[model samples]
Target chain A: MNIEWLSFLTVTLVTLIGSLSLVALYSFAVRLKAIAEDEVRGAGLAKSGAVVCFVLCGCLVLLGIYLIVPQLGGSGGH
Target chain B: MDLTLIVVLVIALALFFDFTNGFHDTANAMATPIATGAIKPKTAVALAAVLNLVGAFLSTEVATTISGGLINEGDNGFSIGPEIIFAGLMGAVVWNMLTWLLGLPSSSSHALFGGLIGAAIAGAGFSVVNYGTVISKVLLPALLAPLIAGLAAYLCTKLAYWVTKRPSGLSSPKRGGFRVGQVFSSSLVALAHGTNDAQKTMGVITLALVASGLQESGSHVHFWVIAACALAIALGTYVGGWRIIATMGTGLTEVKPAQGFSAEASTAAAILASSHLGFALSTTQVASGSVIGSGLGRKGASVQWRTAGKIATGWLFTLPAAAVVGALAATLTYFGNVGLVLVAVIGFGVVLLIWWLSRKDIIGPHNGVSDVDEAGGAISIPTKKQRRKMRKRQREAERAEAERMARELKKAQKNKKKEANGKTKVPTASGSKSRAQEASAPKREARGTKEKR
Candidate 1:
C-alpha cells in the first residue's frame, strides 16, 4: 500500500517537537524551584502555587502544540 | 439472522451496554452518601436511576461526538454493522457485569469504547481507525479527567477545612440538612452521567447505521434509541454495583454526611459542566475525586493511597489495552465469516473468564450496609455510634497495649540505667549532646524516640 509517508512523517516530527517543550519546561521548573528556595519571603503556598502554575502552563502548551500540529490534525488514511 | 433483524438486534445490544453503563456508575454518583449513611443505598441509586434517564434528554452534543468524532464516514466509516455492534456491546456489557461483580470501578466508558474499537477493527481494517479523534476526544479525556478531578477534589477538600478552621459541630446537625443536600447532589450527578455517558452508545449505533446504509448520514438519535438506553441503564442501576460503592464510600475515604454532600455536589457540578462542554469525562473519576475531596474535608482523614494507586494503574492501561484488543479484533474480522465465528468464541471466553474472576473476592450483598430503612445506615448494623463504640473499644485496647509497652519501656530504661551506671546516662554526656544527636537524626526524629537514641 502506498502511504502518505510525508504527512505521516510530518506528524511524527510535530509530536517530537511537542514533546521537546515538556523537557524545556521541566528545566524551567527546576530553576524556578531553586529561585523560590533562595527567596525566603514567600509563603510555602505561593512557592507551591508557582510550581503548579508552571507545570499546568507547560501541559497546556503541550496540548496546544499537539492540537495545532499541522499533519497530526487529521487522520492520514481517512 | 436476517440482515435487518441482525441490525435491530445490534441496536438492542447497544442499548443493553448503555444500561450497564448507567448501573455500573450509579455508585460513582452516590457511593459516598451511601457509605456515610447520608442516604440509604437503595434510595440513592433509585433517585440516580431516574435522573439519569432525564439527563439523557438534555443534550445531543456528546451524541454527535460519538457518531461523528470517533468514526468517520466512507473510508473511516464504521465497519461494524448491527451484528458487530451487538457483539461489541455484549463484550462491553459482559465486562461491566464482571467488574461490578468484583466491585472494581473499571471505566464502563473505556469498556464500551474498547468493544467498539475491537469490533470495528475486526470488521474493517487499520484504515478505519481514526487516530486523531481517538487521541483527542477519547484518550486525552481518559487520562486527564480523573487527575483533574482528583486534584480538584484534593484542593476542594483542603479549602473546606481552611474555610472552617474548626468545624467540630458539622458532625451533629440540628436538622437533616446534609442528607437533603446529598440527595439533591447525587441526583444531579446521576443526571449528568446519563447526559454524557448514555449518548455514546447512541452515537455508536448511529454511526453503524450510516456505515451500513441503513440510515442516512448524520441521522439524529431516534426516540427508540433514547428510550432503550434509558430503560437499560435504569435496570442496570437497579441491579446495583454494591462492591464498587463500598470501596468508594469507605475504602478510599471514610465518608461523613457533610463530606458526602460536598463530594456529590462537587461531582454533580463538574460532571454537568463537562457534559455541557461535550467532554465524556469518566463518571468514576469525577465521583472518586469528589469522595477523595470529601475525605480531605474531614480533617485528619488521609486518602488510601494504595487503592488510588491501583485505580491510577487501571486508568493508565485502559486506552492502550483497548486499542490492542481492537486492532486484533479488526485483523480477525478481515478474514470474513470464519473469523467472525472465532471472534464470537474468543469474546465469550474472555467475558466468562472475567466474570469468573470477579466472584473470587466478592463484596457481599449487604455491601457494607447494615440496615435498609433505619434512621441511619443498616439499622442493627454499624451506625456512627456503633462504629464509634467499636473504634473507642479498639482505641482503649490499643491504649492499654500502649501503656503496657510504656511501662515495659520505663522498666527497660530503668534496668538499662541499673545495668550501665550513674542516673540514666541520657545516651549522652549531658542534655545538649543528646539533643544534638537527636536533632541530627531525622529518622530518629520522625519516630521522636522518648528514650535517647
Candidate 2:
C-alpha cells in the first residue's frame, strides 16, 4: 500500500519548476519592453536573458522527454 | 482457423484510431497559436506533427497503464480478449470522427476508455473492468486536470498583462516577444500531446497482442507498435482538423498572443505532469478549459458561452455515446467470423458516411478562423494572398466592363456612319429630282460649270 513517494515528488517538482521557469521567461520579456525605452545595452542584455530563459524552458521539456524515453526502450517494468 | 488474421486486423484498427486521434485533437495544441497569427496554420500543424512524432517516442508509461492497468488480462474468468478490444477501438474511432465533424473538442481519451469499458463489459462481464483504476487514474484526472490547467493559465495571463501593461493606445514590446514565445510554448504542448496521447494507442495495441496470445501478458510496448502509432498520428496531425481548430481557436474566445502563450504553457505543464504520473488525461479538455480560463482572465475579453456550452455538452455525451457503439460492436463481434466481417463493414460504412457529411462544410487552413472574430468581427483582414487575389479579380472585372463599353461604342459609331452615308445618298437623289425641273436644273448647271472653271 505504500505510495511511490519518489515519483510523486518528481512529478510535482517538475510541474512547479516548469511553470515557474515559464513565468521567469515571461518576466524577462516584460523587462525587455522596459529596457527598449532607453539604454540600448540594457535592452540587449534583457533580450539575451529572455533567449536563455526560453532555452532553459526547452531543456525542461527535454527532461520530460528523457523521463518518458525509458518507456519506449521497453526495458522498464511499469 | 487462425488467430493471426484477427490479430493483424486489430493492430491495423488500433493504428487507424490513433490517426483519427491525432487530427481530431491537433486543435488542442496549435489552435491558439494559429488563432493569434503567431504562426501560420500550415506551419503550426506541420510543427505540431513533427513534435508529436518525437513525443510518441518519449513515453511508454501511459501505454503500460492502458495495456496492463485497466483491463483484466490472462486466463482470469473475466478476461476480455482481443475481439472486445477491437470493438472498443471501433467505438472510439466512430466517436472521434463524429465530434470532429461537429467541430466539438470532445476528449478522444474518454471515448477510448468508454469504448473499452463498454466492450469489456459486453464481451465478458461488468467484473472485467478495473473500477479502482478507472476511478483513480482516468476519471479523477479527467475532472481535475482541466481545472488545474485553467487556473494556472488564468493566473499566468493576469501576471503577464500586469507586468507588460503600458499607457493607453501605446504599443508594448511584450506583445511581439510573447507572439514569438507562443510558437515555442505551443510546440511544447504539441510534444506533450504526443507523449501523452499517442501512448494510449500503443497501450491498446499491446493489450490486443496480449489478449490474442501473440505477446506475453505485461509485456512492454513493441517497437513496431510504437512506430506505427507514432507515424499514424503524425500523418493525421499533418492533415490538420481545421473544423475543430476553428471551434477551439476562434469559436470559444478570441485568443491574443499573450493569452495563447499562457494557455499553451499551462497545458504543457499539466499534461506533462500527468504523463509523468501515468495518468490517462484528456489534452482536449485541458486545452479547452485553459482557453476559456484565459478568456475570463483577460479584461473585457468575451467568451462565447454558447460555443463553450456546446463543447461541454459534447464532453458529457462522448463517453456514453462511445460506450453504446462499443457495446453494439461487441455484440456483433460475438457472432463469430461473420460477425467480425459484419462489424468491419459497418464500421467502414459509418466512417465513410461521416466523411461525406463533413464535406458539406469543409474548413481548411486558408479560412480556419474566419468564422469567429476575436474583435467582434471588427478584424476581417484577408491574408496577403487572399487580398491580392481579390484585387486581381476586381481589376479583371473592371477591365471586362470597360471592354464591353468600348465594343458597344464602336458598334454605335459604325451605325452612325451608315446613317450619314444614307443621308448623303438621299441628298443626291433629291438633287436629281430637282434637276428634273428644267429651270432649276439650268441654274444648278450654271453654278456647277462656274465652280468647275
- Global CA lDDT computed for model 2: 0.73
Task: Give candidate 1 misplaced runs (Cα > 4 Å).
Answer: A1-78, B75-87, B101-105, B162-176, B241-253, B324-332, B335-453
Please write out the lDDT profile of model 2 over residues B335-412, one tens digit for every residue: 888888888898889899988877766664323432112222221224447656766775676566556656655655
The digit string of per-residue lDDT tens for model 2 on A1-78 reads 223445545544555456656755675655565556555667777667666766766676666556556644533214
Give the candidate number with the greatest DockQ. Answer: 2
What is residue B188's positional error in candidate 1, in angstroms? 1.4
Candidate 2's DockQ: 0.18
Candidate 1 residues B160-266, lDDT tens each? 33432323553322223345445655666677788778778778777667766777777677777767677777777766655445554334334544445555545
CA lDDT of each prediction against the hidden true structure: 0.56, 0.73
Instruction: Note the residue pairs that clash in candidate 2.
Output: A68-B58
What fraction of correct interface contacts does each candidate retain? 0.00, 0.29
